[model samples]
Target: MDLRIEQAGDRPAIAEVHRSGFGGEHGRTVADLVDALRRDDPGALSLVAVEKREVVGHIMFSRSLLDAPRRLVEVVSLSPLAVRPAWQGRGIGTALVREGLRRVGERGVPLVFLEGDPAYYSRLGFVAAGGEGFRKPSLRIPDVAFQVVRLPAAEPWMTGTFVYSQTFWDYDCVGLR
Candidate 1:
């Protein structure tokens, strides 16, 4: 398997990965969310996992804001990570995430946030953001689901509300309804 930055030609396969992973309407919604993020978020970082020249997994980190007491700080939100069903148990998703985090951190992003299962993300170095002085943008997101990972660039004073890009809100993907 090969891990690399996503290219234009990878979009269709990426969408398929999400659709296959999520299924039905939610799958399509997540797929569309990926397109919107790529189009609207200039700072978005996307990565793909390929095997046999086919995309098997994808992960994205899009620009978000942290309304810190001192000032608003730039951060990222990891969302819609998907691995092809056939590739699910092979660590493709983990590789995408590890690589995505490394690439985003290299860009000087202080923190990466996501709404996901605690059991899954905790293994990826994420912790409950609420307990660390960060607030979720919506109450719909459970406290346990709102997770965050701090990079070397993060500062002790950078704690605050994590705001997702408008596209997330526009697509109604911020949290569970």
Candidate 2:
């Protein structure tokens, strides 16, 4: 298995993987989120897992904010992590995430946040953001799933509300269209 930055030509396969990984209507919405981010978020970092020369998994990190009353801190948001159904359980998604976070850290990002399963993300160093004083930007996200992980150079006390990009709200919001 090889992991690398996603290229222009990898979009369709990445979308397919998202669709297959998540399934049904939710899958399509996730895939659409990927596309929207790619088109609208110039700062978004996308990575893919390739095996035998085929794209099988993908992950994205996009610019978000930590909206403290005193400051607006730039952070990255991880979303729509996908490994094809056939590729699940193979660590492809893990590889993509680890590598993606590494690259994001190298760029001087201090924090990363996501809304996901604690059981899964905690192993990856994510903890409940609420406990860390990072408030949820929207009431829509459940407290349990809202997580944050600090980068190598992060200030552990960098507390604030997570502000996701409009692209995230636009694509992921249900019943808002």
- Top-scoring candidate (TM-score): 1
Residue 121, model 2: Cα distance from true site in angstroms: 0.8
**lDDT of each candidate versus the true structure:** 0.93, 0.86
- Model 1, 72-120: lDDT tens digits are 9999999979998988989888888899999998899999999999998
**Which lDDT tens digits does candidate 2 get at residues 1-177?**
988889989988998998899889988998998888888888899999999999999999998999876688899999879898887998887888899989999999999999888998998899998998989877777888899989976775688788888988787642222
Clashing residue pairs found in predicted model 2: none
RMSD of each: 0.7, 2.1
Q: How many residue pairs clash in each candidate?
A: 0, 0
The list of candidate 2 runs beyond 4 A from truth reads 173-177
Q: Which ten residues in a row have the lowest lDDT in candidate 1?
A: 41-50
TM-score of each: 0.98, 0.93
Which ranges in model 1 have alpha carbons more than 4 Å from their true place? none
